[model samples]
Target: HKHLVQALRKAPQTAAVGFRQTVQKLAIVVELLLGDIPERAIFRQAPLRKALAPYFQLTQAVRLGNLQRFGEVLENFGPQFRTDHTFTLILRLRQNVIKTAIRSIGLSYSRISPKDIARKLGLDSAEDAEFIVAKAIRDGVIEATLDPEKG
Candidate 1:
C-alpha cells in the first residue's frame, strides 16, 4: 500500500487526471490498511483525507461498536467500497463490531443474558448473541460463559 501511494505521488503532472481517478479508489484501500495504526500518515494528505472521510467514518463506527453508524456508512459508501474492492472486507468487520460490543458489555456487567445482548447489539435472536459471545470467548476477545438454560 505504501508502494502504491509512493508511486501515485511520483506520477508525472501529465497524468494528473488519471492520478486523481486512481487516488479516488486507492484512498479507501490505504485507509483500510492504516485504520488500526496509531500514526496514520495518510490523513496528512488533505485531499486523500477528504476522499477517505467515509471510510474513516466506517472505521470509527467499527471501533466504537456503533452498528447503526456502521450500517449507515456501508449504505452511504457501498458503491465506493465495491469500486475499491473492499466491500467484502468491510462486511467482515461486522463480527469485530459485535465482539467490541461484547467486550464493552463484559466490562460493564458480570452477568448478561443472551436476550439482553441481542437487544443491545441489535442482533436478530438470543441464539445469535450466544453464538457471537461464544466466538468472542473462544477468540479471547472476552472472558465469559454462556449458560444456555439461564442466559
Candidate 2:
C-alpha cells in the first residue's frame, strides 16, 4: 500500500496506465483482506460499498487536479475507499474515457476538428459534437487550439 501511494505521487507520464495499475493493485489488496473471512460472514461485516466512499471522493479530487483535496481525501478516507466497488468503477470509467479521447486526437490539436469528433462519437451533427468537445476542454479532459493555417 505504501509503495502504491508512492508510485501515484511520482506522476508517471502514462497517467492512465499508471492509474489503472494502481487500481488493480488496490483491488488485490482488498481481495487479500477479504480472503480469510467466510463468504457468508462478508455481508455481516461493514458494508463494502460504505467503506469505499472516501476513495471515490479522493479520486474525484484527483481528476479535478485538486492536489490538496486529493491528499486530504486519501488521508481521511483512503482505507474505506479501497474496499468500495462502486467508487472504484466510477473512477475507472472516467480514466478510460479520458485515455480513449486523448488517443483519438493526434499530433495537431487543431486537427481534431468538430466534425471529426462528432462523426467519431456518432453524434447527430458537428455542432452537437463541438458542444461536447468544448465541455471536455473546459473539464480539463483535453486541450484545444486553432491553427491559422488550417483555418
Q: Candidate 1, which segments miss by more than 4 Å at Cα?
A: 1-41
**Per-model RMSD to reference:** 3.7, 14.5
Q: Candidate 1 residues 1-151, lDDT tens each? A: 7676676677774557456546645554444444442234544456566666766777677778878888999999999889777788778777766777788999999998889989999889999888988988998989878787877
Count the clashes in each prediction. 0, 2
Query: What C-alpha lDDT, on a 0 to 100 scale, does residue 87 get in candidate 2?
Result: 41
Which candidate's lDDT is highest? 1
Candidate 2 TM-score to native: 0.32
